[model samples]
Target: MSEPLVVPEVRRLGPARLTAGMDRWDRLDFAAHRRTHGPLPRASRSELLAVADRIDLRGRGGAAFPFARKARATLGAAERSGRAPVLVVNGAEGEPPSVKDATLLARAPHLVLDGVTLAALAFGAAEVVVAVASGSAAELSVPAAIAERGRDPVPMRTLCVPDRFVSGESGALIRAVNGRAALPPSRPVRAAEGGRGGVSGRPTLLCNAETWAQLALAARLGPDAFAVVGTPDEPGTLLVTVNRSPRPPVVVEVPAGASLAVVLDACGVDPGAGVLVGGYHGAWLPPHLAPDLPLSRTGLAAAGGTLGAASVVALPRGVCALAEITAVAGWLADESTGQCGPCRRGLPETVDALRALSRGAGSASAVRRAAALGRGRGACAHPDGVARFVLSALTVFAEDIATHASGSGCGLSSGLTLPLPRQAGERLAVDWARCAGHGLCASLAPDLITLDPHGFPLLRENANLAPWQRPQARRAVARCPALALRIGR
Candidate 1:
């Protein structure tokens, strides 16, 4: 049986942006939302853009791109191309360490839907799509919220995309929406440029679920009121998922310039241990590095990290840093889309090297070499992100690496404190005992299969195929003459 999904407790500190009314026992339905927070104010596209610029609102997604700039660019592209744009609300919280999006979606679904409606009206969009991961709490909550509204000015719908790590990426999400494999394209193309035939197959105004919720609040509160609590550069409350502590992980809404030390303490975590700021694709910082830094993107960047998705994972004192990093690296390797040679080849090798180093059997040079091979060489940022994460681990735990390299390693711990999911999709196995080496699988599905030193097919560690790739994978399975390959969930 599947484990019961634990809904994280919600805590609001400082001024609330997207997380207002979350303390109430009842879910904030449409009527209660309007009664509690007032109606969402309408504004012209240019006016909304001006407010966004004034507030310096950035995407709550990992990238932290300026929301005003994105809106203006997408609107400009729509006008130039004479095509209607589509507004997408991205609620796919695929990052295992982050639960802020899910918290907001489950507790305050109307707020998000209100933001979607306001954005659609501002962009003059005829259709809006709320995209969530299949079987996620947001998948059910969003549609119910939409139904509660009775009628919307623009038609709005919800779609469930594959829940892979890269699948939530903007390019991959767009590809999935366009009926293709949920993988990023080799070339960089903005969704704004090509209109209906572009990267998203439309001039799409796709923003994070939290970003939309922020927009909804911004519309109601206006710029001055919205800018009251946060720092000048990053003004507003940010929802952060705090984990790796003794207490259950909670999603807290904190002001932009709040002290990281205080936030960690509030989340029932010791502030003296190392912290993984941002999600898996982010960096690690010593306890001292975070105390003085504000929780804003600029502050975190100044302290050698980005506030990506506002996920703060406090490393416990006794946990093995090297083992934690190794497990995360292995999970990331398995999550790769296998669309690029660098990601497909370098990540697994990096995982292997890290595993060996964790066990005190491998050289640090091997880990570094494998990590370097992945930098800046993939269709998407997957390889670059993995490289950054691994390199950061090496740098932050240099002493650990040295000690482990000497062959007197830290003993393996019985449990993992890291937040990787227990189950990461399905597995593709090759029965090495059953058949002779054959290269047919590699040729049939090069993107999913590779050849090792002995010419045996090296199936990707996780056999989770995107919806569009299933038919080709099935064909490859059918043609395997040795009948030595099988898939298991």
Candidate 2:
């Protein structure tokens, strides 16, 4: 694979929390980590819960779920059911634009491991798992950190899985670790509830890589000290990935209530155009609002966006907003798991509609219909997220849409600025040169395979079958009388 056009740099603002000592390039070995951050603070289960409640630390992952509540529930479930709880440090870093988790694992692996060890001690877990995306730098860094620790009370292990977009979801991670397909299950179940019998049928305490780091810091600093830097409701530092056009992105740790504009400026990003906060699944906000908005979740929520994964992609001038949206929409459609009807069908339809609008041949009604078809209809949030992103693009760039719809092009060519995965999922293929067009594949997996005008089987556009869909797709391939159907990467 070609190297990324823009690689992200890492830094810290105010006092560093998880990013301490990152600038030195020295791996915080076990001794150094202890010296820098004090001894690994030990806390009882109740004390850990109390500290989490007081600090109001939320998961650093995109969900931003309350950490205290999740911890309490997981502990409660384990106790009630008499099942041991397993601690999982999720360093999958599935979102292409985000780099905080990988940064932590690379520069300060011991801090993260300390956090995991602390959590395991609190939960009385016999084993702890640190899951990194396969082939990531963290895949090597984390295991080395574990080996550096030698023997511990709770054994720690590292597991690497394929780096797909949805594979980082909590349920999907659990499912993947349990030797199942790394796709979200049809039925929603919390890992804390012993969902799908997580990692040997035990209750799981899953937290984002940064969340574990924060817990370790909070245990060392106590609630009041941690609250000194951030807001009242949400206190502590945030790791933000800033992607400015024409420049590589950078990950910076800033206080929660820091001014968004200041953070962007410090990262040398020109927010004069618009900004896509969070990752691709997050919202687009007007650049003018950056100065006044706080970096906290509540503040971003009031501004009609989220601090999702704390990723900020600056939209530069001279690019057509509609064109950019079209590119991102097409990418999202291709990334869908294809398990649910809404995502499999609605996302591609939405992409086509957006493309039509960019060419001045589509109506707003068509785009709206496509968005509605996908919203709230999928087993996972993939469809809903796509709908939200597309709808927001339509609303935020209404003037641009109007101009494009009137046949006056936005005067800019489509240059995709957002980062997407370099590798695409495997797609279904047909051997048209070898055999007759029987259309058996279409009959076997109608959702994934469709009939072309020539009665030959054509894999549906953007139809990258999910784990659940593979069975039928394989069946269709096997049943092809002409021996023409196959899957290709």
Candidate 3:
């Protein structure tokens, strides 16, 4: 493959007070705030909504739903006479491979808090909840920043819950805060409909941390000012996490319409490789066609990818794409909360099929089974993510799959380039041959590993375990007498 392309790292107009005065930021650390371009103005709900409509502020969360639409939805849902709406700063950076949220929470906590406060003030919210999963650096740094607000504190509270990826979703976070499992419930109830804690359940305004930071900027600079940097429809700088490329990843403030290829080139991504436009759930596109593709949602959708949370991961050419996809599928199956049947059964079936394919033992039936198993099998997008990741692998690396199946590897020296989840379950894999078909691994780690009908092991690969649980997992690993189990890196 040609040497990875060197893309220029583009900076936005100004590194305002949000990111601290630092030249750049790691995933986390609140060092100092950039000099505020101006004061924080007090805008009424309608005014803020109007500003959002004019600037076309879409949810920076991968969905890219129009901010105005969400605001209007909340406004329309409010009761005639009741407590104001609730605002939530979704600091839960659930995407395992992406670290952009942690970066904002740690470095620009104040900015995000400011945006949540402003949203609360505008909407007349009774309270603002900065929901973060426990152990996240955000849970600590953000609260400290909120505490600093003192008497003038942003009517905000902190919610530190479990760190599961789906738990970060607006509704899931709502349930988790209410003391439910950190899993998204079936059906969608906009946090706006039943206010988080009010009688009429005033609408809840939930947005990504980076989204809030941009809103803070937009509120200060006005719609026109914010629009100056990005594309007309997708205005303003988007915070993104670029990874697996030649250059170290960064939280770049890329302007909309910047060529995807140019940005990757600037970031020093491998050339002639498959690019993961979104995060793990994102599609795979060949790098050649991405050069002229714009960076907005529409642009990426046109190019057959989602701009996700701006996770641009470049997979080197030599790696087995199927193996990587299957590995991720295996992880997705592990991450399931097991509340529902489809996700519990379907995800593993999909993972097994993918594993079989990766081992070059799967035939057409295996491919069909994998595809079918991935469809609509989870409480949230976990199953869909695994499916898309697998489907894309099948399409992008068709030749590689054929070769691997023909008793040859993909001829790549590199191992799995895609970052895998690092947790207890992922650290354990069953040795098919070594097992006396023992169901002990399944019984001992029932929350994660399960027993197949044939007395073999069925494991959940992406389950996130608490740090303390590592010892127990080690015990499980040690007890596999046949030495049929191993934890992945």
Candidate 4:
């Protein structure tokens, strides 16, 4: 038997975090962190840009855009004299299968904080906000870490937001911090505009928390030292969330040039099945064919996939892939912030069609409906991504889909072991007995609640909208004569 790689227990911390502020914690001592991975001497903006350019450091936040280039683009806007940029460290791990961000926030909060403060210093930003999902463990843990780091006195704040997925997007977080609804705007405005409204209406620089942590690492290592491990174009190790059977969840930093085979072996992944690369917005690949592929942006890009927020999910045999996709489609529809019309109405419609396809109840018309409804009507990539995920699943699993569509046997009853988002904690629920079907709740808060065919209230999606809508949605919550609706935030 081939030996399986033992997935290490990831603390995600550079030496400093392991030491807890270069200080002592309980019986454990981490003073060596600063000695080994001490902060780099502050770099001038030009020198910082040079360091970024040397390593070709790209945003690890899925887009992977060149960091130096993005800095140049945003820096010019930030130089508007006394209107320093707003640096936002995005800690909201919205992808259900992705625990890397939350893991880092919990285990290596200082590493992330180090990156945030470094960027703020580099950008001369007046304000910094580390946004995490409200009510999540991050809400508490991140704040605690920041307070503990008071030893290093950095200008920073924390904004706990609702756990809605789309709200984690860069622009949406900006809008939410500005007291607007936590939904993507209808227009694609670059955040550099820093127009009047939120966060002092200043130029904003947003990046994933992991990306910042890497930046902190890059600063210390310098570009050449950083290039020692990973590929030429993509230097340094990256954090990946590996999900396969038998192995517990792990967050590991594999060199960029490492083979996919090494990663699989490290994670104890079994020989062959479908691999969900990237997150839901990413593509799926079969295992036997994918193992030899290099584990870099260029490598995955060559094969029509992206190394998204670093979520890799391996699906075993016997589980119905079609049914799994269907359930996720439902969850994706429910996750939308529902500020856009196409995403608001279209995602659920797409889910309805996929559900029909799962039950083998829909005709060619149903397939057409699914394809037509959610192609590109959303403000962000949410709707388009859902369409892509479903369409790809249908194409890849045509054999299984045919088995169901023919009303024969797909032989699976929605065995949803393939990881996806699920509702956690208390959420809004309606008492069916008390429902009068007046449709008032749907009308009063159309963005959140909608009326189904039975005139019963159906949740459009999870969100904590603008302050006014909060009260309005709350009023609708109380005004229901049947007292069936209750809002839980």
Candidate 5:
């Protein structure tokens, strides 16, 4: 399958670090990459570890975990087990709206390779595996980049996995590389621990594409130089996926402490509709605090948000917030693999509650409660992520939720701003000619259908289904007494 690799529009605060050379949209070839960033340098394990510490480097793949500490733990485990470590580069970007990782793996492949080579050499890695989405452009781009570097210090191979959310989990990624199912293991295990669960049971160091790129930049710039751009505690730059929704997301580089308000204004997004600080697993920034919030992990945390994967989405005025939230929630629910009790049962119910709340028939507390049920019960972070996303939406857009639940809906259609693999656009319609006005449909789908004084089911104009509403709408159709309720295009 041929997937279109849409190169996102690029923006930068001061100077472009990650997106250094290419004056054009072309991928930076080996020659161009070397010419632009100079030759890749070598570093000892201790040297690289000190560099990570000096820069306070954090992984860019949602968690913002300290890369240096993670590296130390991996190194310690490898030494204790008398096994050389394995290096794994995770380019299996599962977030549909995010292209930050893809931007690095597909465009500036050498920059990321430089970091990979450095890490592999430092830790004496046995082999390196690069995992990308099966049909994504990275599938082609990464292998081509490896071929360019013919005589790498570490032997390299690229494996492809389905680009699903859980497929990016550490254990799941390693499993996929070893030709096993790309699902999180039943027991929790870190790649560093290297049980039989991780790739080939050897100690492994797994980090996302952006984390490697960040390391490459830090190595090239040195500590003081790298610290010049960002905040006191957090240095270096961030590869932010700025969502211009309904259009391709823009991948921008901003100094770590750059103001969220400034980034939004520069990106031409008005945050009157509220701003999402992190990607889907992240929280919505309160509208009042967005202007003052910084882009670092600490800054967002202070404002009740996490800078997860650094995706910033500013909803436009007049779009239905509830509808957009339902779209993403529905996607998250589908991605859950029933790995645990709450994750298996809670996510779907959370989506249903959110859909009803959007239609003015459910309480905000019910949606939050359903979402909270999954907070810490899953074996992985899927349930927790879903809870964080839905609960934040309920808090950040409280006014919108109140308005919708009060039946004075904003009357705006779903902007379709949040991208999804499939748009469930089916609408609920009534076969008025066959209607006996028994009001059974109203009882069945009170969120969607209301009974008029004349006992006919009333639907809003252009009553299209958000992704989460399809199940309820279908059930109402099946159970309608007069055979009056139907769902269609």
Candidate 6:
């Protein structure tokens, strides 16, 4: 049976800057938005960069890259190229453990759009394109918001992209804006340099929904006001997706250095087994340390966890954590774009080894080996993120690993607790004993397959294939000459 997610509720530690009027209303239209957030402030490149640096403004996307650095790079590129810059609003919230970006975009879109407008003005951007996941509430609301401000000063429009996990990548979003396949390009150019030449080959600036909303807040409130609530180093309120199953993940706003335990407790989660600090790409915190850790990046890092996208998940004591990790590892393998070997081959192989460890059927060394194989090897950071998540589980649940490895099992069942869209039980695996290395499957589906050094196929296991890649995956499966490749669910 599938684990069901409860509908999420928007929560806060106190009155918020970004989520200003969200408590009284579900969403803000143009009139309400204007009333709630007064007028959007204008900013120069120097002024914006100064404010960003003073407040330590960073991208809310996984990397948490410094916004001022990216802004300067994009602005510098635009000047050198003598071409007007373009701005992309990344609202494609592909991270399964996260709902913060979508929540902000759906509830307070004007805040995000205001940030976009401010960024456009500072960069002298000729055009601005908003990217939202197809079928998401933001898809409808964003365009409507654009229509509301009919005579757009910067020529804004919406592009509904595939709602797949990788579709939110900066390169992928850029490609979708440029009228191409919504997949990350093999050699992804920085958005600073137009990122696959976005919107008619000009330099581009891209940031997620939360990043933009935060920017708007930073501009409205100077560094001192912004610094009031958060810790000294990390200032401002943050939106987090707290997963306490049977109830969907709650999208809550908390002060920068708030107590992690309190947030999880508010969401009715018991951080007994382990707590996943940052979504699937994040690390698992040991039970003892879970409650005491702070929600800031430095705080979590000290506890051997990452505040990646702030997707906090608390694992209940009842479930087998190893089983949960294995299942999630398997799902993450399925979510890979298969753009390179580490993602296609390494990720699935890592999950297999992890599963073996979970069941006491394999050595801890094996899990370590498979998980580490993809380090610094992916075309993107997807494989590395998966590796971090799996490895952390191994450390946090070492006692369980030893218990399971004894050929005796814990009494707990492997029932799901974390929220995953689907395909945790499926995989694409290669049976080495069954065949010769013909490499035909790779030829059949280059988009989804690649050849290893020995000419063996490296591809997604039981790929919950993307809409466009399914046909290719099927064709490759049918054409495998050695029949070594098989997908099982």
Highest TM-score model number: 2
Predicted candidate 6 versus true structure: per-residue lDDT over 1-489, tens digit per residue: 022222258888866777788777677788888899888888888999899999989888778999999888888888898988998899987877888888787778889999989988887889988899887778777877887766867889899998878888888888888888777777647878763555678888888889888889889988888888988999999998987687767889999989988888887788878888778889988878866889998998888888989998878887888888887787777667677888767886787677666667886778889999989978777888888998888888888787788768777878887888754343456788976888888778775577889987766433455344566767767777777776665
Worst-scoring 10-residue span by lDDT in model 1: 460-469
lDDT of 4 at 151: 50
| TM-scores for every candidate against the unseen true structure | 0.89, 0.90, 0.81, 0.81, 0.85, 0.88
C-alpha lDDT values of all predictions: 0.78, 0.80, 0.67, 0.69, 0.82, 0.81
Q: Give the TM-score of candidate 4.
A: 0.81
lDDT of 4: 0.69
Candidate 4 has which clashing residue pairs, if any?
Answer: 19-30, 178-198
On residues 1-489, what C-alpha lDDT tens digit does candidate 2 reach at each position?
A: 112212257777899877787566446667677667887878998898889889987899888888878877777888888887888999987877787788788668888888878878988885798888887878777887888888988988898878877878787888887888777887678887775746667788888899999999999999999999888888889888887656667889999989988998898877756788878788888888989989888899999998888888877777788878877777777666777788777887787788777778987779989888967768888887777778877877787889888878888756777776555666788786865987777888876777779987765554455555678888988888988878888
Using lDDT as the measure, which candidate wins? 5
Q: Give model 3's clash tally.
A: 16
Runs in model 6 deviating more than 4 A are: 1-7, 195-199, 423-473, 476-489
Better of 5 and 6 by TM-score: 6
Candidate closer to the true structure by TM-score (higher is better), 2 or 6: 2
Candidate 4: tens digits of C-alpha lDDT, residues 236-324: 88887777644457666677757776776776776354777788877776666566777788888787677877777776777787778
Q: Residue 476 of candidate 1: its Cα lDDT?
A: 72
Backbone clashes, candidate 6: 5
Residue 313, model 6: lDDT of 83
Candidate 4 runs further than 4 Å off: 1-8, 11-32, 135-137, 151-154, 196-198, 245-248, 363-373, 421-489
- Supply candidate 2's per-residue lDDT for 19: 76
Error of 6 at 197 (Å): 5.4
Q: Per-residue lDDT of 71-97 in model 3, one digit per residue for the tens?
A: 776766765535467777777767666
